[model samples]
Target: MTIKLMQGNEAIGMGAIAAGCRFYAGYPITPSTEVAEILSRELPKLGGKFIQMEDEIASMAAIIGARVGGLKSMTATSGPGFSLMQENLGYAAMAEIPCVIVNVQRLGPSTGQPTAASQGDVMQARWGTHGDHPMIALTPVTVRQSFDLTVKAFNLSEKFRTPVILLTDEIIGHMREPVKLPAFETIHPYEQVVADTPESYKAFRNEPGDVPPMAPFGRGYRYHITGLFHDEVGFPTQRLDEIDPWLERVNHKFDRHLDEIIMVESDFQEGAKTAIVTYGATARSARHALKIARQRGLKVSMLTLLTIWPFPETQVESLGDQVDRIIVPEMNLGQLALEVERMVGRRKVKRVNRANGEMVTPQMILDAIEG
Candidate 1:
């Protein structure tokens, strides 16, 4: 393993490369531009292709095309750019294209704050697309985890045949830390293929894993992919049967594999009366508060969610039943807190929020624990 000091954006580029990503298409956006910059410089040297699209929508569309062309593809962006990519992002999902989307989140409702850290996009990343679709999103706290999780994100996307979001913030994207890089041979990439014959191809047919292996165009798999609801053959259909199966399969891919697909970290969760819950950067502060509370002889633990979606409802509800109170600290105004309350029921979940382009510190969480 090679230990190198790297920024999170650089780490994502390197991680994608390590994951055998050969196609990158993205328009530059702040706090995330470095990912596009580094990938543009490196991909060509490694016999890969990089395209700087005219805009985020076209960039997303182009990457989907590359994926259909039998290449592992990805795109990166911040708020405004991400907003533009939403339509095609929904397209990728509807067609069940496997790719990674890195959203290095900035404060936003509409370019709310650029070059600042915010987790406000947490809900958007999960539900930003128009309809009901299952999405796999991974949140990384440290720069090293950013590298590791990006690779995992790609793997999950490919394995599930859906677009996976690497939900990160400007803090982690710009943070510098030492990451231990595994050997290229040690890293395994997701599989892809091009159909040898055009006759025997069905783009949306579900295999045992609820994902159909893709064969890129020009390799003889002359198929059409569209954003509209489609049948198993990837052709648009208004039939309820087609729509039902299509939506069911999409949800099945994640639901059947939830235990395998979702990752969560629970610290001192057993028999705790007071618990602090968090994810992303805010979890760091929650961890610190947990440590201090333990030192002061308080029965406080933390459940830091590594997998934000699929909600981890089973685990959260169990923790809630054991704990007298659960305090959720996030960078937004009770976004995750709402989910926690929904899962565990009201009257037990409290929230500590901050939304002014600032980090939630340990004292903030400690006060919640003490309260």
Candidate 2:
């Protein structure tokens, strides 16, 4: 393992290259621009390709096209750029294309703050893309986890045949820390195999609760790709028979593989009455609060979410059952708290929110707990 001090954005780039991501297409946006800048310089040296597209929408489209052309592909953007990419993001979901998207979030409604850290995009990452599509979004609390989760995002995207989002904020994006990474060549990416011949091909195979193998565009396999509901051969279809099974299979795969897609780190204490749940950089503050609370003779636990969507319902539900109350501190205005309330009920959830381009402080979270 080679150890180096690296920023979160740089680690994401290095992680992508290690995961066999050979093609990258993205527009430059603050906080996330470093990810693209690093790939531009590093990818060409590895015989991979990198191009700055016209804009976020084009960048999103280009990565999908590149992925269809048989390369592991990805893109990175900030809040505004991520919003622009939503249409294509939805397309990736409906078409079942495999690609990774990194959103280094900043304060936002529309370009609120370019350099400030905020996890306001948490809800957006899950539901920004239109329609009821399955999503896998992972949040990393440290620069090292940023590197680790970036690779995991690619692996999940390929395994599930969907777009996976590496959702980090500007704080984690710009923060630097020592990261020891495996040799890039030594990291084996997940691989998929297609049908033996064109004669035996079906673009969307009816695999029960599994993703169908995707054949490269020029690999002697020919099929249509569309956002519209499609059959096994990929032809546009409005037929209930074709649409229903695809819907069931795509949505249920994550539930079946929850252990793989959902990752969380928790510090639970027996007889604790409260649990502080957090993700992204706010988890740092939540930890501090936990320490103070413990020293002050309060029994408290903490749950740091590394995977946000699919929302870790089962675990949160368990926390709700075991604890007296759940406190959620987010850089957003309680976006994740809304989901927690749904799972655990509003009565069991308390929200500590900050969206003013500032990190939630330990005092703020501690106050919520003390109350």
Candidate 3:
């Protein structure tokens, strides 16, 4: 491995290539445009394809089509663009098409800020897609993790036959740092093709397992692809017998494979009275505050989330039970804090929030810990 100074967005773009992503389709949007820009320049050099779609909606649609064509596919967008892609994002989930969506979040209700940093999209990444579906959302704290997790996003998407969201923000996307990336040939992305003959293969079969391998569209593995609830053969179905089985399998798949889906890092004192729980860019400040609290002889711990969706509920609950108070720092008006409160009860949680275009400094978190 070689070390190089690279921006996080660039690292994500490079990581996708290393992860065997052969197709990228995106429309430029602030804070995240760099990912698309880098991939546009790099994909062609590596015998891959990159397309600039007319809009974010088309970009999302194109990647799914590309993935169905047997090429690992991805797209990158920010705030408004992400909103435009939601319908298609949900379609990818319903159709069980494995693709990666890199969302470099900016502050937004509706195009609120273009270059600003925010973690406001936390709920949107999980519930924005309109249906009851299991989603995997990974957030990276640094440039290196950005690269590492982008590859992980692709792997998880392929492994579970679902769309995976790489939830990032302006801070991590634009931050510059040195990272050691693995060789492309040495990296592995979960393959999603069936070995059996087409006649015997059922595209959406749930008989033997929750996930059935996806056969590439052009490899004589022709099957219907739609957002509607479908039968094992890929035809839209209304029968409760067919629908219930698909629902059970898709929803329980993540639960059965929690070991691989939930990822977190803990830095806790043996007997800490306070804890900082955070993810995405806010973890940077949380880490600094954790160090300061320890230096001041205060017992403290921190839980940094790498996977944001599927919520790591048990871990957070256990952490809440161990500490007298749980501090959550975010760049929004307490979006994730609402989830934490539900898990641990309102009495044990403290929130530090920032809605303006600025990073939450360590002092803000330190103050919360002391309070």
| Alpha-carbon TM-score of each model against the true structure | 0.95, 0.98, 0.98
> Which model is ahead, 1 or 2, in terms of lDDT?
2
Question: Scored by CA lDDT, what does every candidate get?
Answer: 0.85, 0.92, 0.90
Q: Write the per-residue lDDT of candidate 1 for residues 1-371, one digit (tens) a residue.
A: 77878898999998999988999999899989999999999999999999999999999999898987888999999989888988888888888888899999888779788877888888888888888888878888888888888888888888877898998888889988888877778888877553435787778875535577777777656677888887767778899977877767777677778886778888874567988878888888888888888899888878878778768888898888888789999888878888899978779988899988788999998998888
TM-score of 3: 0.98
- Candidate 1 at 67: error in angstroms? 0.6
Position 29, candidate 1: lDDT: 90
Could you tell which candidate, 2 or 3, scores higher by lDDT? 2
CA RMSD (A), model 3:
1.1
Provide the lDDT at 328 for model 2: 95
